[model samples]
Target: MNNLFLRNQLCVPVKGYNRAIIYDILRKDYFLIPKEHCAILDTNDFIQFDKIEDVEEREELIDFLVNEEIIFQLSTSEQKKHFKSLNRNFENPNPLTNVIIHSNIDFRFLDLIKDQYLLNLSIISQEIDDNLLAILQKVSELEIDSIYLYIENSNIEKLDEYKKLFANYSLIFSVNFFNSKKIIDKTQLSQNIYYNFFEEEFSTYKRTLSIDKLAINAEHFLEAYNFHSYYFAKVYIDENGNIKNGLNNLENFGCIKSLTSSQFKEIISSSNFKELGTIKKKETLVCCDCEYRYMCVDSRVPSKGKKHWFHQFECVYNPYLSKWSNEEGYLNLEESGVYISASGCTIDQEKLSENFDKIWNT
Candidate 1:
């Protein structure tokens, strides 16, 4: 057999307590293998099948990787001259990619951003009214890629209205109805819309991270590698037209109505406003060690300290233990020796090392 090479599209195995993950950026999927495989991936030298002592076991692993298209066989001579690697840099054409509206207001402010392409336009309001419909119609005329509408106290009659609206505005990707008093036939609802009756009302509250929210594609992987997953190119306008980077941010740039197009651009382009977007997860205290950092769209806005940024809220998933809060024998941040405070988090490195050895039986 020739020298085996891991595919460039497959990221190097990231080790966790229980397992290591090899993310296939092109396929938008992942493979979990024994964490010990991390050692195999650490070397830049080629893996020769003939040199292995555990022939049968190593062969089996190689066979599986080949079958899964995660690796390929190439001549050692060709590897030196012809091997290509993925470009890790990422850039987007649009200055603004996402917009969130907490409540409907004078949408004339949209004209400033009308020329810029938007990836997602989210409209969240407490009730559906003429004002909301007017804003929706105005937004429908724009070139937004997708629209997600969230309304509280929705009903069957509103469902029919939504059907008609969706028929007209093909860009309305999904409409989430929250705290509906009456449950309508879900079958009647279109594929894009959903009614969340039992769940809590919609709020811009920070949520815990989960595996489901992870985006496992090349675009997301590249973006997360270069910038903050949530705040990059994102703009949020609250009910009173106050503009901010995100829902939980304390800084208010300005009211949308007061700022001209040039003024708005100046505000967003300023270093202070753009500072948060530049803080990638790799710079965060606890998240830097996480295997899922590149794929995670963690909403909690981390606070920046002199040396590093830290998450104020607790995350549900523990990367050290490879366990979720819902899972059995899960360890929290404190239990794992991560102490979070207003300024930043402090890691009890000795205790963390001890826990790692205990959990993995190393």
Candidate 2:
């Protein structure tokens, strides 16, 4: 008997309450499949197609999988033995990889975490001043990979100065001047750097999820499987030098100035600080049943529950109904009978079952 196997890439089949998603890392895309189909893939071995329902529906599904290059046929057990699935486990050598600065304090405290070799540095400031230049000069000395500058209130008159400052630092690769009096064409800057001028205000706390934010790459999929893509190994320092996981995060570990090298490391390594990053989407309510769980990066702070976490804000997309909030014929998750509370999430199984065929059979 012939056997079916997923293609060379590590294709992960995740089952939701209503549907399932196949994350094709190689193609950088995903396919929505029925929960039953996901269960079939969950077997994760040389599949005997003949052993399935053997109906027209099953044949069509198998054909789709083959034609899309998601799966291939192997004639013999000997041939199957040579095929191996890739390991999806992720590991990072650095304890901290990214730093976000929202203040103009003496950032010299960065020396405490410099040993890990920071990959990215973000600075959020109100204006372009000598303080900004000083910070840029100091950071340019470090072996930092890249710097992202976000100025909330920008002065158009300083573009030439900004260009000169950026040219001085090779690591300052991206810059965004928000609330600019006049919009500047992006092409006005050097090709090596990404500089944009926006007349509208940009808030760090106001976040919204959309299909455009979904990253279908292998690195993101593997990391999202085990950790929070935004908060993991990332630190945010507010204007007063207070450190937190995110800008909106209320809990502050402590001010950077007051902390010693040992204390700083202890704080980051402690469960209290690391717990937020451990909250993977697969372990959260509503998000647990999302087809885009691993691919979508939703970093909004969540309310803690006994077993699972609840989103403090409503998600724009409903995985149960497979519809966006803005689209017509879209019913909110609550209308579908899934309730999120302090304890966790509770679902109306009967309602889910009744709607199953209506959704899939369409």
Candidate 3:
């Protein structure tokens, strides 16, 4: 879609760098559009075509943005010529950054740039209908990446149908699973699992799998399995090495640990092992002391925060301070059902580095 249409589609303020960094670590993939390229344009900054009676005034705003390097501007004649050329090749990736269109109305402007840019069409979940279908069809015809489907609990069934219909396309489904228990359970599969360790009610579960337990489990899982991709959503860690949530929060941690340990021992004992080359240690080191710290094949320290040395922020949900700040040190324990850390210890770089060395040698 054109810039104007995308500008109007934003429902909430974009979570820029923080979101980008977390996803990069979790997915082990780099962002196509770097975080530096993102910008939030306020309403006042918008160029309202309706307000500018004179053509020059309207053109001025467009020129300003192009000069500031915020967006690229093309002459009307040039845009028409480019649109014509777009149809010549459909397989080539469009280099234009994505634009999120907020409006519900039929956006004819989107058709003009569909082949030239990544158009993110956001429609209210409940309001989707035949009109929406037609718009999506036009997008599909252009062979764009895919349409992002945003849905709420009320429209989840419709989402399921949509998923089936566009199964062949590269569709990314975005939804808030916190409130939709039924939908969450329905989507569960062998490869996809969810655990609610952050909730206060699961405090006991949290205590059982302290950082040491979590690290051991992760090592076990990795050594035992040969899998392609692994996905974990909404995970967090705290001081005292306590684990909070994610797949590791599955029931029967004791059994899983026991089984994993036995298997690992068997494999090692049976093998004729040889020592790998060792490298020199550095004077200064950075580390992550999180519960899943060992299991995390991908991990990095946050630039800010006390635990900046050892802990990485893995959770997608905004950290709730009041809940995390509670003296009880458990998330979702009582009413809110959130997970909070008990020790609230920041990262100690030296300790983290030392632990890493110990784990590697063992």
Highest-scoring model, lDDT: 2
Which digits, one per residue and each the tens of the lDDT, describe model 1 over residues 1-362? 55656455445566654567788887888888877776675444465545446878788888888898877766665554576566678978666798888656777778877777888998887776777778878887688888877776566465676676666667777676766545654323465554334233565223546665688988888888899988998888888888899877878989888888988888878888878888888788777767788888887888867688887777888876777888866789889887877566678889877886776674
Residue 146, model 3, lDDT: 40
Residue 207 error, candidate 3, Å? 30
Pairing residues by index, what is the TM-score of model 2? Answer: 0.81
Q: In candidate 3, what are the lDDT values of residues 1-362, reduced to their tens digit?
A: 23441122111111231121111222222222322223333232332444545677556645654443434434343343332211111121322323333224334444434445443333323334665455556566654444544332234455556445444444333322223444434343221222111222222322232222222232223321221011111122122222222223331111112234344223222312100000001100121211122232322222223322212332311122121222343232222222223323334445444543443345
At residue 141, give the lDDT of candidate 3: 60
By TM-score, rank the candidates, best first.
1, 2, 3
lDDT of 3: 0.30
User: Candidate 2, clashing residue pairs?
Assistant: 103-239
Superior by TM-score: candidate 1 or candidate 3:
1
| Model 1, runs deviating above 4 Å | 8-12, 15-19, 42-53, 79-83, 156-161, 179-198, 204-206, 341-362
Measured by TM-score, the strongest candidate is 1
Instruction: Please give the range of 10 consecutive residues that has the lowest summed lDDT in model 2.
Output: 1-10
What's every prediction's RMSD, in angstroms? Answer: 3.7, 4.0, 25.4
lDDT of all predictions:
0.74, 0.77, 0.30
Better of 1 and 2 by lDDT: 2
